[model samples]
Structure formats: C-alpha cells, structure tokens
Target chain A: MELRRFTQPSATKPTHTTVSNSEIAKWNILDRPLTRSREELYLSTFSFLFAEAVQYLQTRVQQVSELEEKLNQLGYRVGQRALELLCFREKLNRREIRLVSILGFIRVQLWKFLFKKSADYLKKVTDREDEYYIEEEEPLVNRYISVPKDFGQLNCAAFMAGIIRGALDSAGFTASVSAHYIHREEKSRLAFTVTIFMIRLDESVMNRERKLAG
Target chain B: MSSSRASTWNKLGDAAYAKSEKVSADLVALTYGSFVREIIKDFEEPDQVNKELEKLGYNIGIRLIEDFLAKSGISNCSSFEESAEIISRVAFKMFLGIRATVSNWNSEHNSCSIIFDENPLAEYVELPPEYTHSLFYSNLLCGVIRGALEMVQIIVECEFVKDQLRGDDTNEINIRFKEMLQEQVPWNDEE
Candidate 1:
C-alpha cells in the first residue's frame, strides 16, 4: 500500500482539518516512542485492544500449551527488550560471575520490573553464596483464573517465563527459567515461583572472567 | 528478522522502568502467549494459525537479543560460560525474578547442570491428571530457551523430571545439551 503523502494534493481537495503537531504526537501508536506525558497516558485507553488480542489468539489454537507458548514468546520479547533498554540507558554494572551476584540482579533488578515492591522477603547467605528468594504475596496476573481439568495443562504465566528466559539467554547464562505454582499448605495466599536454573559456567567463561577480573 | 521493533519495545520497557515511559501498570506477564493461545485455542482447524504464532515468536526472539543485552547489566560476555550466567540471572531478573542455579559440572567442565528451585509458572498451578509427566502449558519455556540457545550454537534438550506436588516432592527438571548441534533445529525444537 503506497502511503499518500500529506504534501500531495488530495484528489478530493483536502476536506479534513489540519492536524497540529501536538495532535499528531497525541495520535502516535504504541509501536512508536512514548510521546504522552503522565497525565495523557493515564487517560488513554488501550486495554480494549489488548483484550481483543488475547481473545483473538485464544480461540484459534488447538492445545492449551501451544497457546501459552505463544503468549510466553511475546512476553519474552517485551522482557528482553525492557532489560536491554534499561541497561542501555543506565551504566552497566561490572557484572556478577558468581551465583550470588546473579541472584542479586534478579532480586534487585528483575523483581523491580515485575513487582513494584522489592521482595518483602530476602535472605542472603555466605556459605553457598549462590541463592536468593524474592517473595511476592501474589503474582498479579494469576489473580483471576484457576486451572481446570481440560485446561489443567496451562500456565498463563509462561509468558513471564519467556521474558526470564530471553533475558537470561541473551545475558549469556544458558539459563532455564521455569514457572511453578506454590500454594502454602496453611496460608490462604498463593505465589508463583519463577526460578532461574543456573548452570555451572563452562571453563572458557571462568577463564574469561579470571582474565577480565585480573 | 528485524531487531528495530524489539529494540523499540525494549526501550519502552526501559522507559516504563525509568518513569520516562508509561504503559498500563497492570500485570503484563500473561498478555503475550495468552493472547496467542486464545487465538488458536478454539479453532476447529488450526494448522495455519500455529504456523503464524511461531513465526511471530521468531521475529520477537531476534529483536529480544538487544533487550537481553540492555537489561542484562553487562556490556558483553567474557566467554560462552560467562554468557550462560548472564543469560540466566540478568535476563531472567530483568523480565521476571527467577534465578536458575547452575551446578553438576562435568569433570572436564564442558557441560553443567541447572536446577529450577523456584518456578513462577508453577504458582497456583496444578497439573491435571493427564499431564502428570510435566507442568502443563509451560513448554513455551522449553521452546524459548531452545531458540535462544541455538542462536548461540548451544544444543540442549529441556524437560521436567519431577514436581513437588505431582511427584511426591521429588519433582525435578532436566535440560541437557546435545554433544553435537545441527544447523537446523528439529520440529520439536520450536516455540
């Protein structure tokens, strides 16, 4: 489709009102850079469109896993991109080669984006120096649906898993991100566990880190 | 195939984080695959739609490389091994807060192991009787990891070996790379 340049004389002699730059900026699509201020953005409506997207994909698929995978891939894209942009603008940290350093990034870096609140729970240990847990009383997205019999093989949050996976894969960890449901035996509250499966570093990586650190 | 769009979105996520950009504050983790799932979940015939959704993931994955770099807090990797650590922690951390642990290295250290101690998708999730072998609807993760790793020339297979609730709390998952990698991934190796 050839775009009709605005400068071209309209065959109908231009009936529409002249658009102001501000109006043009206001009409920008999401694919474009964010141009709206805090006030304008909050007032705008995009959920109807988002909701339509969800409904459209849900009905066309065969198995529930395929559908969830699709959502996860899309979410991974968003997560990967977000992580990149955040790192791009900000000063990149020297980086953590050890497990503790990596987990710290998740507890401090990743959790900040997924949950506005820092983990209400964090325990740092020196012995293993490789693990940390970020506690979320409730994973916001899982608030609505319950896993039923036919759809019991569904993880609505694999999209987040993709994000975690993409971020980890790109960062050079060869990490595996998995989502699990952890419902307390006693407590009424439920939490989704997003675990990053860290593998032992290849000798080449350890050597490189040694060289870089040295 | 294009990185521009994904990079642009990554910028949006950055802006959103920086308070300079604003997207809806609502939870967004379920939006992607759920939307795609919803599209094909009800089709009487869905061969074409499945093709398209995967194509969408491919495009998204290419662009994600940039985002992975930006949010990872590292300018570059020192080696393939360091690259692995960055991929696991920073990438996952920026997107969601899951840290996969790497362990059980081969004596020569060419290969290693990872254990999924805390999985977010497992939250409030119970596998139906039919999916007793694994977590339902989480294969996208297996696909996403496969796609990402293949881009870097790492050949791996991922699967769940156990589940805390599903398998008497002896639940475990195993992801092992093939000793040899084919240029082309298998059909099962798609997201």
Candidate 2:
C-alpha cells in the first residue's frame, strides 16, 4: 500500500495551535455530567494490567506484607476515585450513614460497577460487632494470578481490601480492611477457593453509629 | 525434519491463538488511555511520560511473553522473519484481538513494518494540540515488542512510525532487528 502523506494547511496544523482555557474547561472530564449505564471495559486488559502491577510490586518489595501494603495503597486511590464516580453516577443525594448500609453499598453497588456482579457473601463477624466480612469465591483481580507455594499466604486481594478502606475512609468511616484466603473442601464444585475481605471499623466509627442509631 | 518441527510448532501456536479469551475492546482502550493520562499528569512532561509508559509496557511484556509461550506452546523461532510472522499472526491476535500485517521488508530483510488497521489503545482518543509533537501515544506498544523480542534473544528496535490519532493514513510500527543474543552456557563441574 502506498502511504499517502498529506500536508495540512497552516490554519489546520495540529502543532502550533493554542487551546484556550475555555476549550480546556469544556473538555474537562470532571465537569462532564455523570451518565448512568456507561460502557464496560475489557476484563482481560484489566487482568493483564493487574497481573503486571502485582509483578511490578513483587519486584520492588522484599517482604510479602510490603507487597500487600503496596497493593492496598494502590487500591485505596482507586477506591477513593471509584466512590466519587459511583455516587455521582448513581445520583445518591445522601452519604451512607450506617455501618451495614455502607458495607452493603460496597458489596453490591461498588462491586457491580467494578466487576459487573455483586460479591458472593456479606457477613458480620459473630464474636466482633465492629468487624464485617465481604467474601468472593473468585476475585476479578485474582483471575489470572496463581500464587506460588512460598507466597501461599499472599492474597492479591489486598488491593481490593485497600479499595474498601479508601472508600470507607472517604465516606467518614475509618476502618482497617484486610483480605484473607479461605480454603474449603466440599462436595460441590464451587468448594475450595474463597477470598474474604475483613473490615474492622474503628472505635470512633462504631460509637458514631451507635449515637446515630440511638 | 526441521520443517516438520516448525509445522508442529505452528499448529501449537494456532491452537493457543484459538483458545485465547476475548474481552471488550472499549474497556481496554479507556483503561489504558486513562492510565496513560494519569501518568502524564503526574510527570507533567511528555518525554518522561513516554519513558514511563514504555517502562510499564516493558515490565508487562516480560511477563506477558511467559503467558504467551505457555499458551502457544511455542519454544523457538527459526528466523527473524518467522518471529515477525508469529508476532503479527498469533501474539497480537490472541492478546489484542487485532491482526497486524508485516510489510515493507527492507533490502537486508532485517527491518519491516507492522501495520494496524485499528488500534485498541487509541480508540476514541484524540491527541490534544500541545501533545501532538511530544507524545508518542502508543509508545507502550513499541516497548512491548522490544521487550518480548529481547526475551527470545532477538534484539530489535521498534518505534511507532505513524498513528491514526495523529491524522496518519494508518497505524504503523517499524521494527529493525539488530542482533541475536547468544545464550551463555554454564561450566560443567566434571570439566
């Protein structure tokens, strides 16, 4: 194929033209109105990128905890942005006021938007009132990842935990979120693998919830 | 015998290519574009942003080759031309769901162009006026090719020669093979 190279006229040249402030403002993504039912991105791309991110973090961090912390930090930033975006798109006029409500929101709304489906289970810790669990049989982030025997304790779901923490923190609920891998043997095919994200709300947050409820 | 072996490898590559999963192209483009935009915002310099994107792609490429090899069950390429064909036919299709054509072979046959009719990364993207000259929007692709080739012991220089986002006729990535990296053999204890 003959490559056709055309010279653009001076007025149409892309290089020298200055974009005014008005144009920049008009094109600003923040200024755009949030639309419901946005198109979904490719899951494979996300998986590949997440895999690379984990690989990159693995190389940088010496300890398993360090890698988890790094992943969590990365997810925290994403969670913050996702919270804002989800709220805007859903047109929610009020912030989540209760512990259960916010956790429900994360498990349902946030999960739906990010993964196109809700998490498998949301449960309260029997012994600890302040601790809650959001579980998934297969996490989207961990779809392509296979943890080695040495790094058996490492749950890549730490990124998701960070996202939960970031979202909760931004919503005025201070909490520590950690991801744990639970292995179960059952007769059914869906038996073995499960990732549970534990959310531990701070004392102040629990107190505030009690005050609001009472 | 070598031809038969090559055919067997080709069959494996085809099977791998066929078995690879598909995903939404829009998602890939938006996520990648947004990530690049975020990097650009952080660096606040186009050159630095390009370097960073390339570095990221290089990291991805190194790991991606492992996935590719495992999936395709292909161990080696007989020549640089064969590698180029495999990349265009099998690797790009399996990963990106886009087919690239290898063309414009140089006199020495060491250089060629991979032309993309459509680019998943540049979908719905327009370069801002200021970034037209400074940003090589898909520099990551070049880095990926370079990194993957290097892993196979083929040292190649790759660059985005043209982009549709830049009002070019088509998207073309030019690759020039420099040299093959020789494998180092370990010393035997008995020797």
Listed per model in order, the count of residue pairs whose N, CA or C atoms clash below 3 Å is 67, 2
Most accurate candidate by TM-score: 2
**lDDT at residue B40 of model 2 (Cα atoms):** 77
Candidate 2 chain B has its poorest 10 consecutive residues by lDDT at B22-31
- Candidate 1's residue-wise lDDT over A1-214, tens digit each? 3566645766768588865433332332332233221211110112322333444456667888776766566566656655664464345766556544555675567656544544444444235323233344454444444557787656555555665566655566544444445444446545444422223333554555567667
Kindly list the per-residue Cα lDDT of model 1 for residues B28-129, writing each as its tens digit: 333433443444444423444434444443434344555555544456543445544554544443343444545566676555544544433333234346
DockQ of each: 0.04, 0.14
* Cα-based lDDT at residue A106, candidate 1: 55
Q: What TM-score fits each model?
A: 0.37, 0.63
Where does model 2 exceed 4 Å of error? A1-43, A88-95, A185-191, B1-56, B62-138, B149-155, B160-191
Per lDDT, the best of the predicted structures is: 2
Tens-place lDDT digits, model 2, residues A1-214: 2333565557866676765422432343344334512244335556777776677668777899998997887788767767876787678888888989999999998888767779999999999989999999998778888999898599999988988898899999999999999988888666687999999999999999889989
Cα error, candidate 2, residue A5 (Å): 51
The per-residue C-alpha lDDT of model 1 at residue A77 equals 61
**What digit string (tens of lDDT, one per residue) describes model 2 on residues B110-166?**
999998765667654678988977888888888888888888889888888887666
